[model samples]
Target: MNDDEKTRDYNKAVAAFAKRYLPYKQPLLKTIENFSPELADVVIRHGLYEIWEEMTPLLSYRDKEIATLAALITDNTVMKEITAHTENCLIQGMSKKEVLEILTVLTLYIGVPKIINVMDAVKQAFENYDQHIKNKG
Candidate 1:
């Protein structure tokens, strides 16, 4: 395919993928775009097009959310992302028990103190999910 066609196809694929799997992020992306348009483009193109699109087909969506949540839990930075992915874990069909279990597993590797921080982030996610999404339906 020509360069223009390739770009078009890539964008189309990103749109479809983001719509289904990444809708939780649209508000965050829009907020970032409002302050930094170029960074927003890079986040969208790199994350959706390059990262998620490539990785998602290799795992079920639920598995992908688990993996992402685990990574965010371990990194111990990016509190907001940790919260977002924790919520996404539920949106992807994980029960609250399953989500909490991730913390139990991570405690073995990350130690109790760090896991404490992760626990609070997860608590916020759970509260948000319960209040906003879980009982609505």
Candidate 2:
């Protein structure tokens, strides 16, 4: 494909992927698009569509969400992302018990403080998800 065609195809794929996976309808990408289209392009095209969707053969969406949640918990620096992935986990059919168990077990490896931080974020994420469903209804 020509460069223009490749770019168009990539943008289309990113849009499709982001529509499905992005949190809060992707306000993050939308906000950045105005001032930083390139960064937004990278986030959607490479980060979400390429890295995430292209891994479906090896990892299911639920597995990816679980892994992402675990990493976010360990990092404990981006509460918003942690919460977003927490909601994504639930949306992917991960039960509250399963999520809690995962976090609880992580306390063994990643320590209590980081796990505690994510625990709070998880709870809030659940609450927010519930509210979102209600509002949508």
Highest-TM-score candidate: 2
In candidate 1, stretches whose alpha carbon ends up further than 4 angstroms from where it belongs are: 1-25
Candidate 1 lDDT over 38-92, as tens digits, reads 6755666556565666655878767877888888778899898888888878878
What is the per-residue lDDT of model 2 for residues 9-63, given as tens digits with 9 covering 90 to 100?
5677657555444346566666767778788767766677678766565998889
lDDT for model 2: 0.78
What residue runs in model 2 are displaced by over 4 Å at the alpha carbon?
Answer: 1-23
RMSD of 2: 2.4
Model 1 scores a C-alpha lDDT of 0.74
